[model samples]
Target: MSRSVFSISRLASSCRSRLLELLFPPACVVCGEALDRPTPAAFCRACLHEFAEFHPPYCPGCGATVPQPLAAGKTCGHCGGGKTRYDLAVSLGPYEGLLREQLLRAKKPTGEQVAVALAHRLLQQHSEQLQAADIDVVCPVPMHWRRRLRRMTNSPSTMASVIAQQLGVPLASGLLVRRRYTLPQFQLSPTDRLTNVRSAFRVAAGHRLQSAHVLLVDDILTTGATVTQCSRALRHGGAARVTVAAVARSYSDR
Candidate 1:
């Protein structure tokens, strides 16, 4: 394009931004306060400051919050052992308060924007480690096709797209898939959670990992069953490493 055309295009984009700002002011998702400025993460400055978010030192294995500044190593009991087959894990924080509210909303079909925003929030919060993890590809914990068709939106994959784009990695979607639908983890006993998701996932046939390091994304981590099972499939299918990422993790209240 010519210099004149470039300048006109830039000016038109600026005008569109300004017009939108005037017509619909940006507001915080949590507190509904008008934002002085907004990024894709979308929370206002005050809410960002006041929110009780998760921070390290993270448990090296399961991504659970370790009370002290511990280095990465083994599976923490919070997620139980061996079952958490992923090499490492990271989470936005424990699911509670506004964070829990956000996740619950994301489960609905109308909550696509909420799901996308939460993915940005997770990436924003864990930017350093996630970006530095040397991940070759990103994939969401796959949903069963039947349920996905019924719901009309797959929140985890939707979140995974943002993560893959931000990380400059391929979104290896359908790399892992549901073999059969299982009951929701939250409804079962911790032991049942294990058996429930066991054998529920499998690596899709043509997408062999060839030992690539993978970052598996999920919207929530409750008992850790689903993700661990997903990781098992990835590892068994030849992934060199598997790390799990969740937008929120639910800890037992007791």
Candidate 2:
């Protein structure tokens, strides 16, 4: 019967998975600790606990963790400075501990699995806020074609695809394009970082972003200059609002 055949197929698949696990034991992505069973999440329990999530008392505009308590309705210095073009920004956690290592790994060719795991975690933590934002479209901060070719993968695009799928929103990957390849932002001073990214991004021709609520996804937010420039381009393209989401927030310069 068809039912019997289906049961046999499932059994075979389970046996194959178990055999593979025995042949090549799975290890945690962050610590290389052995896992009892195969897991797509890629992190072991101890390593997962080390990932610090950004909580309340953080900057609503830039998602940077505030060192001192502030009265409600007051903005952090970073937000008050008016450097970022996006209306709001949120991140999974500050760039440190296990989260930092995971992000570094996510940049390499073998780190796609880790990146997917991080994206899923981001979705789980901020799903409610993302839903409330009423985003019309999701777009990743684009990388220059040459850079993307060398990297073999774009983390922002990978994260954005997962977010769009979970949110049931359209992902406009080509809506914004990075025209010029610049040096990595982390190496530059804060002022120089702004200059490095200025006028580097452009909205793709014929892409109608007018009046659209766009969610801009990136891997890590350091000085916010890159996202700010990208936001400006989206605004010029007629996007009504822009919100940024990233896997980590770097406090090195802040």
Question: What are the lDDT scores of the predictions, listed in order?
Answer: 0.81, 0.84
Give candidate 1's TM-score.
Answer: 0.91
**Alpha carbon lDDT at 151, candidate 1:** 83
lDDT of 1 by residue, 115-177 (tens): 888889888888899878899999999888787888888899989999999889999888997
Clash number by candidate, in order: 0, 0
State TM-scores per candidate. Answer: 0.91, 0.82
Maximum-TM-score candidate? 1
| Count of clashes in candidate 2 | 0
lDDT of 2 at 76: 73
- Across 1-254, the per-residue lDDT of candidate 2 in tens digits comes to 69999999999999999898888899986778998877656678887778878776567666767786555555477556443578778888878877988888888888887888788788877888899999999999999888889998888888898899889999999989988899888888988998999999999998998699999999998878899899999999999999999999885374
lDDT measured at residue 182 in model 2 versus the true structure, 0 to 100:
92
> Any residue pairs clashing in model 2, and if so which?
none
